[model samples]
Target: MAPTTLVLNAGSSSIKFALYRAGDDVSLALRYKGKLDHHAGDVHFRITDAAGRELTAPDAHGHADDPTSALLERLEPLLGDDDIVEVGHRVVHGGPDFVEPVQVDDAILRRLDALSPLAPLHQQIGLAAIRTIMRTRPALRQIACFDTAFHHDMPPVYRNFALPDLGADIRRYGFHGLSFAYIASRLDAHQRRTVVAHLGSGASVCALLDGRSINTSMSFTPLDGLMMATRSGAIDPALVLYLQRTREMCIEAVENLLYHRSGLLGVSGSSADMRTLIGERNAGARQAVAQFCARAAEHMASMMTALRGCDAIVFTGGIGENSPEIRASICDHLAWLGLRLDPVLNASGAGVITCDRSEIVARVIETNEELVIAREVRRLTQSRH
Candidate 1:
């Protein structure tokens, strides 16, 4: 039986997992990938092989009482004879301390749990998964790959706010580091000074200089950046104060408003999914789409300023890779930067979408955060031997 590594990316509603064949060497090959979703109080489990063929039945269900246990039970039969030697997790926040992947222990778990307040939507979910695995499979080794580790070395100018020294804890710690790191690895050597727009439900723009993050749109938390599907994104600090003072909204209520109730859903008054908003003709939907594109373009431009100039603009993430219309709309706003899209190539939805004469090249590259996690896990685990 070959050794395997399991990578888990836990979100607010689901835990996406991938199993990889971990050889004695550095290279890892994917075996299976799937999600454990919690919807309407029911747990659903699904799995697919590396070839994208469904391995589990459509109606496969998980235990509502213990979703993690259900996930293990379902995975057991599929494992055949392969043994899962180590598990890697996508933890959203590493704060100021962790700049690289690290093994998780009780002390490290406590430290991660303390960071939950900073990444309210993701930190807790990831920690819960880690704790569950530790309890159910106590002997199995686990490692944490942080989402903020990529931008941990970003210049202080981009990392600090205007406020007085509030200590090391309160600084601009960017999210989506795993995605950015993967995108960087895929870029051409000549594509230095690139601005990558990771547009999805949780979106952000990042500036890469020589394949390393120099600046990013998110600051301190995921809430500060381009407007996302359900997040308000970069709002004026005074507006938060105003809401609390005159509106008399409590801290929890205000948090709920910005993190869950705002952005596309709040503006459109219906759905948060970009695909849904794109097909609708309602005025609210139209406005929401327009606003999302505009705000995304604006943030991309901001990342360009940090790079002094942009050599290329790469789009990744769900909305960035799939939606040609949205990509065209965003490029239309960036025309001033000498970015001209090849309509035919843009429609193809992959590869270079920029015209031959365009000053700035634009391309669509699908990101693989799970693979990044698996690679890190392999590296850390191998180093011990």
Candidate 2:
């Protein structure tokens, strides 16, 4: 049996996982990929082969309340007789420490758990998966690939807030670093000054100068930056204060409002799924879509300011890669930067969407955060051997 590396990328509502065959030379090859989506109180699990062919029936796994346990149960059958080695997790927050991928131990897990407040929506989920694996497969090695690592080197000007030094850990520790890093790897060397918009359930804009993050929209937490599927994104600090002081809402209630009840769902008063909102004829849905696109464009422009100018704008993540209408709408707002999309290319939803004469090149690139995790796992494991 071939030695394999398992990568788990836990998000707010789902856990994406992939198995990669680890060769003796430290090369990685895709084996299988799947997602355990626990959205709207429903649990669904599915897996696909390297060629994108469905390897399991749609109704293979029944609904379950616990996503973590369900994930392991469903994944066991797929493992068959393969010899699994290490597990790599995409942890959302690494705080001021862990600028690179690190092996997870009890002490490290405790430190990571303390960062839950920083990334309330995502950190615990990833950490929970890590802890579960450690419990069930105690002998197996586990590694953590942080989402904030890519922005660890961001300039202080972009990383710090205007507030006094409350703590060293309090800074613009950007999320989606794994996604940004993958996008950077795909960009041409000439595309030094780039603004990447990772639009999805959790969205953020990043400025890449010389293929390195110089600035990003998310600050301190994933709840900052562009409005997401359910997140309120950047809001006035006074609004939060007012909600607490005058509205008499408790801290937990306010956190729930911003993290779970706001954004597209709050604005539309219907759904948070962009695909659903796009097809709806309701005025609320239309407004939600408009706001999402506008806010994304505004944030992208903000990232451009960090780069001084932008040579290219790359769109990745769920909405960015699949939603042509969204890509066009966002680019429409950026027309002032001489960015024009070829209607044909935009509709195709692949490759360069920008016109030949456009000053800023725009393209759609599918991000592989799982692959990034797997690569990190490979590097860590190889070094030990």
lDDT leader: 1
Tens digits of per-residue lDDT for model 1, 1-385: 9999999988777778899998879899899998888776688877899999987565446466566667777777778899988999999999999999999999999999999889999998888888998998998899999999999989999988999998998899998999999999999999889999999999999999999999999989999989999999999999989999999999999999999999999999999999999999999999999999999999999999999999999999989999999999999999998999999999998699998999999999998999999999999988888
The C-alpha RMSD in Å for every predicted model, in order, reads 1.3, 1.8
For model 1, how many clashes? 1
Which candidate tops TM-score? 1
Off by over 4 Å in 2: 38-43, 57-63, 76-81
How much does candidate 1 score in TM-score?
0.97
lDDT of 2 by residue, 21-110 (tens): 988887998988988888666788788999999875654344444676677667667777887788899999999999989999999999
Clash counts for all predictions: 1, 0
Clashing pairs in 2: none
